[model samples]
Target: MQVGGKSQTTWQPLGWTGASGGGRVGERRWRLVDVAASAGISTQQVRNYLADGLLPPAGRTPSGYRMFTERHVRALAVARRMAEGHGWARTREVLAAVHRGELPAALAALDAGHAELDRERAEIARVLGAFETVLDSPAAAVPRRDARIGVVAAQVGVRTSQLRLWEQRGLLRPHRQRGTGYRVYDVAEWRAAQVVALLRRGGYPFDIITAVLDELRSTGRPDRVRAELARREQDLHARSLRRLRGSAALSDYLAETVPAGTH
Candidate 1:
């Protein structure tokens, strides 16, 4: 049937306007154990999902035993997939809002996850741009020869104490002379210091600088920057796909659920 230019689904109530998670009227009920078996999880785990708001409320027998159906089963499966993409904490928030009949809150939680990924992608692009700029600057290359802390600090125009602080923060690591106990940096570490100096001048935070230098350190060649960025882009794409899949599953699961307060 078509309503308001949208195709109606079998599992949806004649009107599915409320919120998610309850069996449609007249569906045959299943035991809680049956619902657990259908999803290959232990009954105790299913109970935990219920307590955790990962599944919708179950029906009840006249004698007060818990009753369930495919609605609950689909909720379990859809929730697991949502967790796979959105993380367990986020999935719990979404599901809890859903069971409370708060569809808007549930959708907002999903939107926030997508927005976070969008921000990460933006950061990756920004890092790539900054990295290219730094590669063309005086920070371009490092010699394999060793340099003491003072020399590297002078080359980067940063105070030696600042370099020591960066080391304390785990932003970079330099070697020590075997007996003299002096900090010494070679090509890889010097390049890291230079990158940190350039990014700090550009106002990048320590966390982002760490990520940039970590990636750059993998090969230490300017030409390899794009390769790393490409790999990171691919990872983001995979995560986006997983979230999309989770949303699609959620749509189907919601359609099958009875309208809130109708049961």
Candidate 2:
């Protein structure tokens, strides 16, 4: 539906608004709501994107009504998809490249994002390997039940704060010594601490470590840790694939539509 000068209070599907009164693809024009409806976003969101130099500027009607075309719709669509895995800032750079008709730059931005995710996946693998190796070792079977926090930290090469943070987050449950109430790391707890430290060094968030540790403690299976990492790996892999597909789609759009200009 077309709203010439007034803002739309409710959203509706876009309909063709005549700018040249022609049915041809290049001759047709759309209102702001029409573009918003076509893109499945609110008019305010489109305005915000426009202000951020995300959307191409709309042409003005004789009486100052904003006019849009299919090009704008396509731009918004690509912007939304690019924002999914790559953050808004990165998406902005990518979309800017696309809107300026720089397909290579846009695709390069996508490739860079994919490469970063690849590095992240490799790191996850390394961390999971460390966790599994520690779990499988005979040395892990020995109980250093009375080991203090400092000793455990020193042995594992972690800070006391790291251990305390892990314990606070429910990733570890080191026993407290009687009277003194100091933390005492048993064999199992120390192993868990090692796992946490390795994962942290490899860039796993504390919450994810907590969940993986909980699964390990409940199932007593070291493989559960690998399973969690595998799930994350699959998720990142899927997201990377989607970003590539979006890049292809954006390339197609850039090929067809001319960019407004450099922002």
Candidate 3:
């Protein structure tokens, strides 16, 4: 059906005798109600899916109605299946996989697995890069020389609140002025905070971070500290890989059983 500023095509189940199916591959657009009916869901549910980022942005008519494309319909169907059948919380993962490379025969299932792996690999690479930067930089001689919370947080891609929390936990001790109460940290402290931020981003919990910080503070050996951090990062990477694999497998299984046309 062609409406105000868009077009739509309906999907009919394939015929047993191989006749022309009701659905057309090149269908250009769909109304909100049409999409909801085709996906066996309510219009409100469709809106909910869009709000949750499950569906991509749809074309809008001059009359203010949403118009969906074939791709959008297929994607929404896959996302609905994954969420309802496989318990997947994120739809972006499936969509990303589809966009990353050529999709396989079971597009939705393949996308789910690929997306999870891709995410983990990217995260691992980022953490490893941070680890390398910290280990390679020369340790500053003075411990509390030039730490700016905002600057350091921006440099390390962490939140300022995180830096403050680390300071409160004694993991970082930037110099404080007695009269004005301004916090200042030296080069060494700044480097230490950078290292802490790297590990925290790699998913290290507070307790482990505290323990590692304590060891570094007590010993003050750059080489030993670097080795310890590397070891911990490797260990965490392995654990993350295992979890990623498990999540992919679960998603694949769920995708298989999900109803194909569910919104």
Candidate 4:
């Protein structure tokens, strides 16, 4: 078949035999341009596949134009299939394997790797879904500022005195209303309070904590915040692992001394 001035070949069934016209079984041939167009990829990509040894060499027409045989089309289709079914990263590996005559093994490896990635992605998605559910619940409501210092402290599971100390140290600045003669904290202040609580829990001194918060507030860049948080998380994770190992060692020591049936 030809469409839009490009010659195309209908992919015959697997066992199709040409009608005694000297063509091989399932041998519907097409021009390179047509195959590239039908494949929905650039002609350069097809050429790259051929150059990269993913596809077999193309035959030439009488006028010197490049023509593709049924086998070439099949190879291109396989490459496209791999690229679509798996990701580009794995597709390159699979294509290299195909070139090296280990296609079956490559495909099996791709399947296993894809299955593992899918499992991991599903687990992550499940955790995210659960987090979203909790976030949507009424118990997770975001509190408004200006209610009371104690209210903010209670909401964040911190003491009012700690919050006041943070405020005095310039780590947090709540809104002050002249008419009401009261300091009311908004969401930003609440977030600052949470940061201060985390820093205090992490054993950071009040002076260092104040400086960090000051720099963060002055910059207000999400990237800086993300990098800082990532570092903190890594440090906390390492500390927690060390604590867990220590606890396990203590438990083992106790198990060795105490009788198994002790009350």
For all candidates, the clash counts are: 0, 0, 8, 0
lDDT of 4 by residue, 80-194 (tens): 6555445455555655554443445455655665465455445434433332332343443356635668788887788888888778878889887679767778777776676
Instruction: List runs of model 1 lying over 4 Å from the truth.
Output: 1-25, 138-144, 176-181, 218-225, 255-263
- Model 3 spans with C-alpha error above 4 angstroms: 1-145, 225-263
A best-first ranking of the candidates according to their TM-score comes to 1, 2, 4, 3
Q: Stretches of candidate 4 above 4 Å error?
A: 1-43, 57-68, 116-121, 132-143, 146-154, 158-185, 188-263
CA RMSD of all predictions: 7.6, 10.0, 13.6, 20.7
> Which digits, one per residue and each the tens of the lDDT, describe model 1 over residues 135-229?
77754556669999999999888999999999999987998999999999987788788888988988888877877887777867767878879
Residue pairs in steric clash, candidate 3? 8-29, 12-23, 144-186, 145-186, 146-185, 146-186, 146-187, 147-185
Window of ten residues with lowest summed lDDT in model 2? 11-20
Residue-level error in angstroms, candidate 2, position 21:
17
Of candidate 3, the 10-residue stretch with the lowest lDDT total is: 13-22
| Candidate topping TM-score | 1
Better candidate number, 1 or 3, judged by TM-score: 1
Q: For residues 14-42, could you state the per-residue lDDT of candidate 2 as single tens digits?
A: 23233332223465677889889987889
Q: lDDT, candidate 3, residue 40?
A: 91
What's model 3's overall lDDT? 0.58
Q: What lDDT does candidate 4 reach at residue 219?
A: 56
